[model samples]
Target chain A: DTAVSQTPKYLVTQMGNDKSIKCEQNLGHDTMYWYKQDSKKFLKIMFSYNNKELIINETVPNRFSPKSPDKAHLNLHINSLELGDSAVYFCASSDSRTGFGEQYFGPGTRLTVT
Target chain B: QQQVKQSPQSLIVQKGGISIINCAYENTAFDYFPWYQQFPGKGPALLIAIRPDVSEKKEGRFTISFNKSAKQFSLHIMDSQPGDSATYFCAASKGGGSTLGRLYFGRGTQLTVWP
Candidate 1:
């Protein structure tokens, strides 16, 4: 079974439209993260949730919000999507107890704004 | 400031050759270092990782050389094969935070192995 999974592998929406990407992890990890990879292949962290508590929030725009209902799920909602929002979004999870923790990434969701 | 910087935006190596990619970080608090490999249209996967306490780590054909004093690290791929071609990323993080570990990724280096 896939450890970490994401839905809506591809998204195409008009400018100013709203969309969401859903993520789920089966590894029983307490921490989940959202990362964005731009056209330049530069990956950057956006937000992180640990056991349903928001922990890390980067300098992302207010239009982008992350919601985690529980430890197993974290979803990203983007409102008023702009052209610059085109990128691949990745969901990852890791066990917090391990000192050498490494993130397990899910197949990304590619979002395109036109 | 960019927390982590990586060199060689891309690399091409012949089969059986060794491939090397280097990275440096500005934060001394970053004690955990990891390298991730990504294939086209897929998510980046952790390949290998090292800690500041260790100078080197080897996993199969992949090796990580770390210099704690300089705050630099590198990934070395031995006997690189055509199938090993992919983008590699070096990341660092301080593991004790509430988020578990929030990583700062380097701009990926695309590696191509010529058969």
Candidate 2:
């Protein structure tokens, strides 16, 4: 079984459209995060949730919202998608109890805004 | 501003040779440094990690050299093999507080090991 998984491995949409990416982890972790990787392979954190509570919110646009229903699930929704939003989104999970800083990432969802 | 900076955007090494990737960070509060390996079409996976308390940590063929004084760290791959070719990313994060488990990743280095 996959430790972390995301739905719609590849998504293609147009500008101004809205979409959502769903993530789940079976690793029994207390912390979950969303990260974006640009074309240049630069990864940046967008949001983080601990035990379904918002923890870290980076300087991202208001159009991007993250919702965590439970500790095992976190979803990201983007409104008025722009071409610049075209990138690979990754869902990661880590156990705060370990305090080892080892994050397990999902296979990633490649989103394309045309 | 980028918190972590990685050098050698790309690297090529022969099988059985040594492969090295370097990274630096500006945040002194970061205590945990981790290295991740990502293959094409797959998400990143933790390769190894180290803390500021130690200068070096090694696991199998992978080793992390941390220079806390210089705010720099490097990953070394010994006996490099074709199977080890992938993109490597160095990351740092503090242990606790509002930013707990928040990782600052460096630009990935694409490594290609030729057989």
Candidate 3:
């Protein structure tokens, strides 16, 4: 079974379009995170949610929002998608007690803005 | 300053050779250090990790050497094979009473093992 799964392994959209990427984890972890990997391969944290409450929000644009209806899911929605926003988005989860803070990652969703 | 710095953006090694990637961190609060491996088109996967208390940790052919005073750490892969080629990232996170936090990752090093 996949520990973490993300929908739409690939996303292609036009500018000004609204899109959402869904992520779910069956590991029953209390924390979920959204990350963006740019073309240069730099992985940056965009948002983090602990038990359905937002905890960490990086200097990301307001156009991007994350919603966690429950602890097991965190979905990302982007409004008026811009070309610069085209990048691979990844969802990850980790249990607070793992000591090593080991994060399990889901297969990335490649977003392309045309 | 980049919280974490990685060296040798890329490396090439022959089969059965040794491959090494190094990283440095400036935050003393960071106590948990881990390395991740990523294949193209895939997300990064945990490879190995080490804590400040320990100078080194080894799992199979993968090893992590840490230097607390120097604020540096490195991942060494022995008997490198073509299958071992992948992008490797070294990351650090706050420990102690700190809750699970987002990790600070290095720019990553691409390893190519040629047969």
Candidate 4:
């Protein structure tokens, strides 16, 4: 079984479209994070949620929003997607309550905005 | 800003040789350092980690050598094999009860082990 999983491994859409990427972790972790990997292969954290509470919000655009309905799921939604939004999005989970920050990552979703 | 800086965007090694990737961090508060390996069409997987308290850690053929004073760490892969060829990433996280899971990752180093 996959510990961390993401839906729609590949996403291709046009600009100005609204899209959402779903992520789920079955590892019973308390924290989930969303990251964007640019073409240069730099992994940058966009948002982090702990127990459905938004904790870290990087200097990301307001058009991108992350929602955590429950501890096991965190979904990312983008409004008016732009061509610059094309990148690889990865979801990770870690149980910070245990005092260790070892995160498990999902397969990643490649987003392409044309 | 790029908190972690990795060197040699790519490397090529022959089978049974050694491969080394180095990284450095500017934040002195970072105490936890971990290396990740990623293969094509897959996410990164944790390979090994070390804390500032220790100078080195080893797991099988992979070894992490750290220099706390210099804020530098390196991953060494011994007996390089073609199966071991992949992209390696060096990451660091804040320590001392701070936001622990916010890892600052390096650009990454792609290793090619030719048989």
Chain B TM-score (each prediction, in order) = 0.95, 0.97, 0.94, 0.95
How high is the lDDT of residue B86 in model 1?
94
**lDDT tens digits, residue span B6-54, model 4:** 9889999999999999999999988689899999888888899998999
The digit string of per-residue lDDT tens for model 3 on A23-86 reads 9999989889999999989999898888787878989999999999999999999999999999
In CAPRI terms, where does candidate 1 land?
A: medium
Q: How would the candidate models be sorted by DockQ, starting from the highest? A: 2, 1, 4, 3
Total backbone clashes of candidate 2, pairs 3 or more residues apart or in separate chains: 0
Alpha-carbon RMSD of each model: 1.2, 1.1, 1.3, 1.3
* lDDT of candidate 4 at residue A77, scale 0 to 100: 97
Residue B112 CA displacement from its true place in model 2, Å: 0.9
Worst 10 residues of 3 chain A by lDDT: A93-102
Cα-based lDDT for every prediction: 0.92, 0.94, 0.92, 0.91
Worst 10 residues of 1 chain A by lDDT: A94-103
How far off is residue A17 in model 4, in Å?
0.3
Residue lDDT tens for model 2, B9-108: 9999999999999999999999899999999999999989998999999999999999988999999999999999999999888888788888888899
**After best superposition, candidate 2 residue A108: deviation in angstroms?**
0.4
Task: For model 3, name the residue pairs that clash.
Answer: none
TM-score, chain B, predicted structure 4: 0.95
Q: Report the lDDT tens digits of candidate 1 across residue range B1-115.
A: 7789998899999999999999999899888999999999999999999989999999999999999888899999999999999999999988775545788889989999999
Chain A vs native chain A, TM-score per candidate? 0.97, 0.98, 0.97, 0.97
Better of 2 and 4 by lDDT: 2
Candidate 1 TM-score over all chains jointly = 0.97
Question: In model 2, which regions exceed 4 Å deviation?
Answer: none
TM-score of each: 0.97, 0.97, 0.97, 0.97
Task: Name the top lDDT candidate.
Answer: 2
